[model samples]
Target: MVIYGVALLAFCMLVGIILGELLGRLIGIEANIGGIGIAMLLLIFLSNYLKKSFNLGEITERGIHFWSAIYIPIVVAMAAKQNVMGALDGGFIALLAGGIAVFLSFLLIPLLSKLGNK
Candidate 1:
């Protein structure tokens, strides 16, 4: 049933949040670390596994695809705003680091593209 898809997503989210919390604590931080990203990855992996191995029906597939399409962007947008606020609060060094990271990522795109071609 389509409900299974929801259950799988909830399970992934739970695992991700718990892992993120543990990781944050391990690193001496008081926040969840990469929880949402972990959850998204889990959902993607698990959903594909289910589809391939168990023959998860059309209904379940559609449900998972629909919610993922709708939910992830909203969650990511919220997280991005929080990150920006936190970075701003952290000071100029945080901003400089973010800017450098962005610049490096942009520089990597062409190199990555070339790697894909070869």
Candidate 2:
């Protein structure tokens, strides 16, 4: 059922949040570390495993797809909660490091694309 897919997503999200909290505590950080990433990975793996191991209906697939389609926006919204202005105010070093990281990431795009082509 489509609802089952949603239920699965909810389960993954809860587990991810718990794991992330645990990880953050373990590392002495007061944040949910990689919670969303973990949830997304869980969704992907579980969905794929279910698809292969059992026969999922079209409605269930559609439900998964629906959430997947909005996943980016959800992630963006979650990330937007971070204090970017505070980071910027921290120091020029933060700005410079961010700029360099962005530049390096941009520079890697071509190489990454070439690798993808192969």
Candidate number of the best TM-score: 2
Q: What is the C-alpha lDDT profile of model 1 across 1-118, one tens digit per residue?
A: 8887777778899999999999999999999999989998988888677767888787877767788688778998888777566667988888899899999999999998999595
Clashes in each model (backbone N, CA, C under 3 Å)?
0, 0
* lDDT (Cα, tens digit) per residue for candidate 2, span 1-118: 8997777778999998999999999999999999879988988888788879997788876766898799899999989998878987979898899999999999999998899596
- Total clashes, candidate 1? 0
lDDT per prediction?
0.85, 0.87
TM-score, structure 2 vs. true: 0.65
TM-score of each: 0.62, 0.65
Candidate 2 clashing pairs?
none
How far in Å is the alpha carbon of 27 misplaced in model 1?
2.1
Candidate 1 ranges with C-alpha deviation above 4 Å: 71-104, 115-117
RMSD of each: 4.3, 4.1
